[model samples]
Target: MDCLTSKVQISQFLDNELPQELLQPLFYHLGECEECRNFFVRTKVVHEGAKNVEYAAVPKELDEKFAVLEMGEKNVSLMNRKFTISVPTAIYSIGAVIVMVLFIYVSGTIQEKQIAEQYRQTMNLTMPFSEISYDRN
Candidate 1:
């Protein structure tokens, strides 16, 4: 019944489905609701105009041209997709192999360095605590 709450109810009333209790409130609302009235009139005009119009059928030549263009676009897209895949696959494969080889070589060098350090430690055995002392000069 309130103007703010009556926008939708008034629209329904204009569609001829006014409930017995709502008819008076809906009418009163529409009289003061310029926005709702404008919407109703505009919608009614559009509905009437559309009802009198005819749908035109697509022309055969236009349909055929659209089909050809769509097919050509799809073919070009597929070729582009194939090119994208092939370029990345080849480049990534080579890059992955190079990375793996580098990782293996680095690991081998680290292991060799560790072994050399162990050997050096064993050769440089520390003197006994009793046989060594710091000079306080």
Candidate 2:
């Protein structure tokens, strides 16, 4: 198997879950390539480290917080209501949209004027050259 394919199967190979056909080729590639060997070593070290590490115990404070929150939830009533847009909020939203549209329009007009100026300058520079070419032809 190629190095790329073998790299993908490395974890599965360590766990003895890789297919039999790929096993020998992967081992051969790992032995021949120094980079792959180093990668394999790092992966193996990480795997072993993870396996030997102990999980921490949960804090007692978390249980107390949950108990207080459950008590609060029991005293609260769940409310279901339809959403409505207030007139002031709707007016502010419309004003924001209009400001954005005006900004875009002004910016676009400025860009268009700049592009036109550039085109005129290019034409002015090439006018003499065009006359010379026309005379030669």
Candidate 3:
């Protein structure tokens, strides 16, 4: 119904991928909006131009280089290859390790606090103030 939604649907309409239920609403919006209409026209023109473009054949030298590279890749044995870590993988591994360490430290601190609280409570119960007295003669 809106211009933005209509513009997105325009591409789907051009590709014949828009559903039957959505077609009328998009058409209505396109009829009312000039900017969307221009967008639809431009996209249609580009799509038609791309469709009319002829495929260029690859050069013989480039094709030969690719073949050599493919052959070299196939000849390499898996056992002789060295393993490597990608940048993203290394970063993520370090991040996970840091998170795990922080979790352990925080949990340990909390457990220690709980134990100290329990010890204070037990000592208070065993030595209540009312049970102690001072004698003077």
Candidate 4:
């Protein structure tokens, strides 16, 4: 167990969440590494400090403000309003779609042309008997 691996598992180790297999190796690494040991100590101190600290209560005015904001948001009929796209923007979007379709069509046509060329080459190379004609009575 290196310092990096131990650092990742340190939080879990502090919370007693590591399995028995990992627990021994992690303790061994921490015992050998002084830096990691100090880090673990500082983390423990911070955790203890956080546990002892008191949190402030939420004010009643904040709740009233939030209610007022919520009521104002509800009063606005967003679904009932009509959103209009400008003429130039709508034209540009349609133009983009047209360009995309044309590009796809052109690419498919090019692939078909390439396949046809390959087939023609293969036919020319294999059909040597077609050029020989016989005269029969």
Candidate 5:
């Protein structure tokens, strides 16, 4: 492995699923590599935060109103022996070789370094949706 530069995959690396041989190299790289270390931390925070996003509640009245739309048994027939393979189920299946590559192109080049770019790409991919708990008057 050429040490994945993409923060999304870096997250998976931090989770200890990467090969054992690469682990030492990754740790060493993170120790000395400023860009990678920053990426790792930012990606990790977003990944953890994603696990905590809560689903909004559906009002009881709305639930009752939509209750009639529930699927009826008569419309659905189940096989006596429950064993089948479906086409849609294979999405992102095992042994899938999906290689995603990232490239950086800069515009309006800066002469000096200052503030770091906000890690929106990594966070957007990692974190689930969260809304502010606003109180209205």
Candidate 6:
């Protein structure tokens, strides 16, 4: 087995959770790989040390504050909520924005076409006849 797999198995072994089938392979790998063996030893030491350490109890004042916060959170009901948007309202809002954008775009396009036509008409009226060409080739 690889060192990575062996290290994970080592942790599982210390926790007494390694599968029976894997135990022999992990032991064999640990016996051969010095680096993984050292890692396993260090992890075992830390795990044992953690088990021996004592946990302190929470202070009464802090516990009381947390209890008050929990009560406050639980007291607020779903019906007491103020603001919410329905699906139809959101759909209508999106549709209105799309319509407005299309209106503006179409109006701008029509205005540009009208301006171009007017410019062509003005040029036809102002240019001399000699400059006009009637070639069809």
Cand. 3 TM to true fold: 0.44
- Which consecutive 10 residues in model 5 have the weakest lDDT in total? 99-108
Between which residue pairs do clashes occur in model 4?
Answer: none
Q: Write the per-residue lDDT of candidate 2 for residues 42-117, one digit (tens) a residue.
A: 9999988989899898799988878988777666634444478999999999999999999999999999878876
Question: Model 4 — which ten-residue stretch has the worst lDDT?
Answer: 125-134
Off by over 4 Å in 6: 60-137
Q: Sort the predicted structures by lDDT, highest score first.
A: 6, 3, 4, 2, 1, 5
lDDT of 3 by residue, 34-88 (tens): 9999999999999999999998998999998889877877677554788899999
Give the residue spans of candidate 4 off by over 4 A: 62-137
- For each candidate, what is the lDDT? 0.76, 0.82, 0.87, 0.84, 0.59, 0.88
Per-residue alpha-carbon lDDT of candidate 5 for residues 23-73, written as tens digits (9 for 90 to 100) = 666777778877878988888898789889999999999988876666443
Clashes of 6: 0
Question: TM-score of every model?
Answer: 0.32, 0.42, 0.44, 0.42, 0.39, 0.43
Residue 120, candidate 1: Cα error in Å is: 99
Root-mean-square deviation (CA) per prediction: 18.1, 29.6, 23.1, 24.6, 43.1, 21.4
3 against 4, candidate with superior TM-score: 3
lDDT of 6 at 73: 67
Q: How far out, in Å, is residue 107 in model 4?
A: 99
